[model samples]
Target: MKKAVILLSGGLDSTTCMGIAQNEGYELYPISFDYKQRHRKELEAAKKIAEYYNVKEHRIISLDNVGGSALTDKNIDVPEYKGDGEIPVTYVPARNILFLSYALGYAEVIGAEAIFIGVSSVDYSGYPDCRPEFIEAFQKVVDVGTAAGVKGKSIKIIAPLINLSKAETIKLGTKYGVPYHLTTSCYNGKEKACGVCDSCVLRLKGFAEAGIEDPIEYEK
Candidate 1:
């Protein structure tokens, strides 16, 4: 089986990516980051999702020094319900860059053929890092910088849900039997999801549009 490194965040999209990876018959090496984000509960959810998949490695790297966005710094407040066009305060600077960098290194070490990240351009939080152009640029970085790439074995960076809308993503995930209930999307970092936050709101909207009720609990 071909090996793939998946950046699993224990959120709706990332978990859906995990399902997609499995469906594609890859030996999953799921990686989660502990970047001092407000929603640390997602880490626990990541663990559960990894367990569900029975992956051999579920590496959780600590990135406590990486702070700037509201998600990472407690001093910053997580803004509620910003429209999709405006890049919100929650956009962690260079987060996807840092994440893909780590995944690229790990893929080289493990001889993995692909790296999967679940970043959607449509129905997203206006994070610039989640854009296709950024992913394309980072793919070039992997090709030029990695030993595997120099050896003519370039690891593919796959964003399977990049162009899909949130509802479309949910539909695909449902077809793959993604366990959405095990994931968390609230930026509020509480035990229950604050449904009003952008993440939660998008997730709810997706599930609603997909004609499936979200299994996770949300605060009233």
Candidate 2:
């Protein structure tokens, strides 16, 4: 069976990627990160989603918190949704970069053909790393930096949700029967999602647009 490494953040987007990858017939190897993030509940959510897929193995990587962003720094507060052009405080410093690097390494180790990340440019929280130029540049990095690339068998860095809006992503995931109930998108790390945070707001908005009820409880 063809294998793929999925970067599972236990959020809507990442869980959707899991569904897409499963639909594509790849043997799933989900990899989640524990970077001491403020929203650590997502880690537990990741476990549930992985189990829902019945993957061969779910790898959880524990990374040290690089404390510049609100996601990692306790001193900083998670702000409400701001659709402004500037990068938000929740943007983990080079988060996707670090995540992709780790996924690249794991992909090579497992002889996986591709790495799946669920990042969407549309309906996102103003994170610069989620943009196309960044993914393209990182593809270049993979092409030059990895043995797989040097051997001309480059591990493809795939972001299937790049062009899709959150509602579109939700619709697609629903088509694949993704267990959205198993995923969590709260940045507050509370048991009940803080509906006002950027992530929860985006999630709720997407479910609304998709004409789907958000399955999780929210502390509005």
Candidate 3:
């Protein structure tokens, strides 16, 4: 059986991608980051998703000290961009790179050849880390840095949602039987989702565009 590492964020996209991995019959290693985000509740969601899927292993690595962006800093504000003209304040600095690096390390340790992340460039909030170029660059890094790569084993960075729009992601999630109720995509750490944040807005739009009502409740 092929081993695969999935960057499970407990968000709709990641959970959907997890379904893809499971469907592929990959021995799953689901990894989530505890990166001091304001929405720590999402990590709890991640845990539930991991447990629900019965993955081979689940790891929650801490990135608390890697602070700077709005996600890591309590003082920083998450921006509500009506539309993207640039990267939103919610864009965590080097987030994808940091995530992939850790996933790479975990993959190496666990003898996995592929790492999956749920990054969408289309219909996105404009994070540079979500781009195909970034993933390609990181793939190069993975190929060169690992013992498996040096021994003719190539590491693949899988971004199943990279080219999909938010609506398309939602459609695929539905198609794959993803547990949307278990996913959370709010920027607030409160009891309910603040439906005004960029993430909440996008998620709401996704469900709407998919012609489906969201299972999760929001604090409008």
Give lDDT per model, in order: 0.91, 0.92, 0.86
Stretches > 4 Å off in candidate 3: none
TM-score per model over all chains: 0.97, 0.98, 0.95
Question: Model 1, range 28-138, lDDT digits (tens) per residue?
Answer: 999999987876699999999999999999999988657778898889898888684988888899998999999988988898999999999999998999999989999
lDDT for predicted candidate 2 compared with the true structure: 0.92
Candidate 2 local Cα displacement, residue 217, angstroms: 1.1
Model 3 gets an lDDT of 0.86
User: How far does residue 23 in candidate 1 sit from its true spot (Å)?
Assistant: 0.6
Model 2's number of clashes is 0
Residue-level lDDT of model 3, residues 49-128, one tens digit each, is: 99889886899998865667787787988766477457777778888888888888888888897898999888778888
Q: What lDDT is reached at residue 84 by model 1?
A: 48
Task: Report clash pairs, candidate 1.
Answer: none
lDDT of 1: 0.91
**What is the per-residue lDDT of model 2 for residues 34-114, given as tens digits with 9 covering 90 to 100?**
999976789999999999999999999999988999899989988988787778888898899999999999999999999
